[model samples]
Target: MSLLEVSDLRTYFYTEGGIVQAVDGVDFSVNAGETLGIVGESGAGKSVTVRSLLGLIDPPGTVVDGTITFDGQDLHSLTESELRREIRGSEISFVFQDPMSALNPVYTVGSQIAEVVEHHTDRTATEAWDRAVELLDDVGIPDAAVRADQYPHEFSGGMRQRVLIAMALSCNPKLIIADEPTTALDVTIQAQILDLFEEIQDRYNTGLIYVTHDLGVVREVCDRVAVMYLGEVVERGRYEDLFNDPKHPYTQMLMRSVVTPDRPVSSLDPIEGAMPSAVDPPSGCRFRTRCPVAIDDCSTIEPPDYAVTSDHAAACLLYDDDFAGDPPVLHERTTGGGRDE
Candidate 1:
């Protein structure tokens, strides 16, 4: 069985304006030693979906439906106290986006990591401290023993991120949810952090759910990719297949926007129109308003995930054999003229 399986998950925010459907019927799974990249534009519900798995949704938001099974146990069945005691940190850890915000400025870096170890395991304080230093060293931090005693401000952005990673690995979790772990770091530091994640996953055989909008990072680290739009998974498949020949119009537009080495600067075509509001998204297919090949049925009948291959699926009406007119071609708009044929 998969290490983590999320089925028909729906998280909604009870806002003053209206109920914001942040995560609307999403489904995916992660296996041990595998890295699944959840890529989408902001407000696409990538972070919200992962948060729901751990029962981290706040007051305004609620996980209204669906099941989150982690390591064969249904997460929803566990009480808040039980989840905190047995599941969180001990089984499934999280490496948040910003270390500066996530880390306690008052406490030493080692103390924070040690706290988790002590809380989750029967380790003595001294043993937890020792383990903290060992974890820092494992994550490629220099002068681990000395640095562990230092505060968050003492370390650089990259070092701080490493510290957070070390803390996440403190209890030897089976699954690690890294929510944009490389955010705000320089390109060089980002590369280093990505490399560190690779090393950790390889060494520990931990399942990873990498949540990021950066397609470049996904290309470098992810084995499988899930593309989300308007809180729904528009396309999902092996990275190679999704990148090379995107089945969904949304995925195709996203790939066209990325600055790849092979694709020229002039070839970068941004998807026109903004994402529809999640509070009251477009009818039928959520992406129909922005889809280049959207047909009448796309606005009336919701298209289920169409199997393009054994493992590849796309939620687009065009994939249906009965789709009217010519098949939609992914084209790049040129500077001088119209879209390339």
Candidate 2:
């Protein structure tokens, strides 16, 4: 069985204007030692979906419907206290996007990690501190002992990110949810962080749900990819399948926009228009408004996850059995790892 399975996950915000459906009917899974990359444009509900898995939604927003199963246990069924004590940090953990914000300025990085280790395990304060240093070293922080004495401000952006990772690994979690952990770092640091994730998974056999907008990063680290649109998953399959021949129009557009070292940013084909607000999104297919190949049925009939291949599925009317004719496909551009419509 998969390490994590999320089904019909719907999280909504009760706003004065209207109910903002931040995460609506989302479903995906990841196995041990596997990496699942959730990729999409901003406002595609990638972060919200992962947060909902750990019951992290705050007031004015809540999970209205869904079952988040981690390691065969229903996370939704666990109470807040239960989740804090039993699930989070012990079985599952998160490496948030902004490390500086996630860490407390008052506490040293090692103390912060040690606190989590103590909270989740039966280790003594001294033992937890020692484990913290070991974790920092494990995550590639040099001179771990000296670094352990430093505060969050003393660390660089990359080092702070590594500290967050070390904290996540403190209890040896079965799954790690990294919400764009490398988004704020430079290319060199981003590559290093990606490599760290790969190395951690290889050594620990940990499952990972990596959320990001960069398909290039997805290509480098993800074993499977889920393409989210608005609050729904538009496409999901092996990374190669989605990049080489994207079945969904949204996925095709995304693949075509991949920025590589060879492909200059000026030559990138940008997708038109911005994502619609989650509060009262368009009826039928959520992506229909932006889909170039949208048909009349796309306006009235909400497309389901149609079978695309043995291991691939796309929520597009074009992939439905009732649809006629073949759909357009992506071709690898001359620029390595780039796709063209």
Estimate, for each residue in 96-166, the C-alpha lDDT of model 2 and write its tens digit. Answer: 98998889999999899999989888999999999999999999999999999899999999999999999
lDDT comparing candidate 1 with the true structure: 0.90
Estimate, for each residue in 48-122, the C-alpha lDDT of model 1 and write its tens digit. 999999999997999999999998999988999999988998899999988998999999999999998888789
lDDT of each prediction vs. the true structure?
A: 0.90, 0.90
Measured with C-alpha atoms, the lDDT of residue 285 in candidate 1 is 93
Candidate 1 weakest ten by summed lDDT: 332-341
For each candidate in turn, the TM-score is: 0.95, 0.96
lDDT score for candidate 2 against the true structure: 0.90
The Cα error of candidate 1 at residue 165, in Å, is 0.2
Which ranges of candidate 1 are over 4 A from the true structure? 331-341
lDDT of candidate 1 at residue 133, scale 0 to 100: 95
